[model samples]
Target: MPSVMEMKPLATFFVSHGSPRTLVDETPTTEFYKKIGEYARREGIQGIVWMAAHWETPYDTIEVSSNPNPDKDFVAFVPDEILDWYRSYKINSSPALADRCCGMLKDAGFNASLNSTAIWHQDVMIPLRWMYPDSSTCPPMSLISVNGRFDPYFHLKVGQTLRSLRKEKILLIGTGGGIHNLYTLSWHHIIYYKDTTPRTKPIENFAAAFRESMNESVVRNEGGPGLGRAMCRLLKHPHFLKCNPTPEHFLPMVYAAGGCTSYEDEGSVNAFGGENWEMNTQLNSNFVFGLPKDDTIFLGEGS
Candidate 1:
């Protein structure tokens, strides 16, 4: 068998893991999640390094969730039954990978710490349950906390530090929405609308502007550092605040973009299909970067 480092490189993904309910909701976003799961299985993924919007720590340090079986941190405002159901989902973690991740971050001058008892948040579990439904057979995984200070570039550097993991067939996934404004969400629409059809209509005004800007930056044929820098600039975008009332959700995408810094081809960064708008407040435009050239067909699956 080929050595782990000798294995063909796999892509890094930026997934917009919608709501906690997405686990049960059969929306377009969930469909894409299933497709990505197929893509990962076909690619022979061995491990996962998940950067979750829900797992944010202080700016001075980064925490790597090291628990062998991390517990779920239930989301608020949901029905009690849903929370009970969510508790049943579990993830088998990779302690070796977690330690390796911590060492790598520290070597890169980051204040990396190991979190032996971190709680798994919806941002991490929702997409995992959808993509890798069988937790028992799912790849060994671990979570990396985003900087609580919500510094885009800081997260980018963190991604850059872990870029080498892709060569080992370990998927790096950053789960956060492209457009997340809970205050603006259509609560009534979400409650009354039962149709599972994916929202494909083009978003207007500030949402459109922000999404376009993000796509342009990601597709630019540049090094990891350049892409990371380009993505960091979005924090200053006029529509940024409108799209992301809080920085947590938006910061993970920067980490995803930063992970792509290792690839230089114009097509290194490709958007996944199934762009969906939820409650007119969340936009799920997922991306896969550093894909092998021969696997262009996989690109057709999402973008």
Candidate 2:
């Protein structure tokens, strides 16, 4: 295998997977993630390294799936059929790759190491496994979470550690949302309405602000303090309290952004889907940071 430094540039994504109940819904979010799988196939991604909100550790650790039965059923959210397929296929869980990522992080003036067990079960993995059932093209790297808190420095270090992997033809995905506060959403309002005319103004406004900040980040190419400020505003949005009671959902995006050498060099950063896809889900925002100017198909329509 090539050195981590030689890996291809990685694409970072900040997606929102609304209500675990949404998983069973045949809506735009499901379609969006499916389309993302297609996009990954076209891009020829060797494997994916995901930072999921569902997974967190008491300490900073990177888990290297080394189960003798690497395919054992670990994620309960996925169907049994998918789990069986994952178990049967012998995907490459390269220890060398994991080591290199950890080493790179340590070399970059940060503390890092690897673990052999999964820290959490990510919802996105469900669609990802379905998209590449063969397992030949969808190997993954699991990062252990540090408590439930969203530690920017720790995540930034994780991204920096994985920097070498990007050049090695791997894709680094930061799976979460820009503004998520489940407490408020689950209690304050409803995401879906019967009439749809008098839509939830609070949610709509929140999504708009989130998109505006993301767009501004892409345009400015170096959002620095502006990004932090925008994120604060997003967190304060009423919907945030309902969508994400904790910061875990929102922090992954920040860490993912910090990993990039520059926004101008990052690949397409966009959301998948969740509620009111046509109205609120900014799926068409093909915002690219650090991606080639000629790459127009970065974000594809839902299948």
Candidate 3:
């Protein structure tokens, strides 16, 4: 097999893993991930470098493990069915790639270190489990921690530091809710919403307005750039706290954004999961920064 260093650069993704309930459904979002996996195989991703918002340590960290399995935390929050689905997945990790990532980050001047820890957040496990289906088939995976500080500039800088790994075909995936604030949305929307048919609640509304603003900010086009503006509006957004009670969920975007080829590098924006967290705050939205094999396709799956 060709080593990761031998392969070409792979794209980075901003994956939205909404409530755990969505994992069992066969939805567009889930199909989007399957196609993404197919795309990754075509690109020869040596291993996965997953940067998750759910896992945060004071210092930048990476997990080194061979044949890893995801840890199901907070299983009691959901139904037995959800827990059963979560328990069915066994994702693998890569120790070699973890070491390489640590070396690269340290050389790049970031406070990087390695641990033999079993770190699996819903953000990391749910998407991959649904996307790959078969755990062993996954490439060697390494876990990267979100910094304690939710500074966009800092995370972006951290992403920039790891850009070199792309040459090794290491995939950088940022997993968390783009509009992640479970506290605001109605529980009925979350617990009751099924994957098929028209959603009981409209995809738009107060939740969508914020998602729209986020959409405009990230998707580059003739309308011009919005990263600068988006960053500014985030704090200003009336539901900013409701959308993001804490920084862990939203910080990954800054890191993902920082790692893109350029601010102008075009990506796709996907808005789903209408379950409003608080005051019409929707835990929806995801983006990707990379060259798509199909120019017409956004993140290998069009919105």
Q: lDDT of all predictions, in order shown? A: 0.77, 0.49, 0.61
Per-residue lDDT of candidate 1, residues 205-285 (tens digit) = 888889888877766544345666788898999999988888888888788777777544234545545567776657877
Candidate order by decreasing TM-score:
1, 3, 2
- Top-scoring candidate (TM-score): 1
Q: Write the per-residue lDDT of candidate 3 for residues 1-303, one digit (tens) a residue.
A: 677556445566677666665566555556657766876877767778877877787644433333244465664345576677668766667677777777877787777777665557687777886667676688878877886454566677666777767767777777776676666565654445532223445645655767766666666421113443354456567766655777777777666655554543435232222222222444545666655434444533435
Better of 1 and 3 by lDDT: 1
For candidate 1, the lDDT comes to 0.77
In candidate 1, position 92 carries an lDDT of: 76
> Which is the winner by TM-score between candidate 1 and candidate 3?
1
Winner by TM-score between candidate 2 and candidate 1: 1
TM-score computed on alpha carbons, candidate 2: 0.66
Against the correct fold, how does model 3 do in TM-score? Answer: 0.77
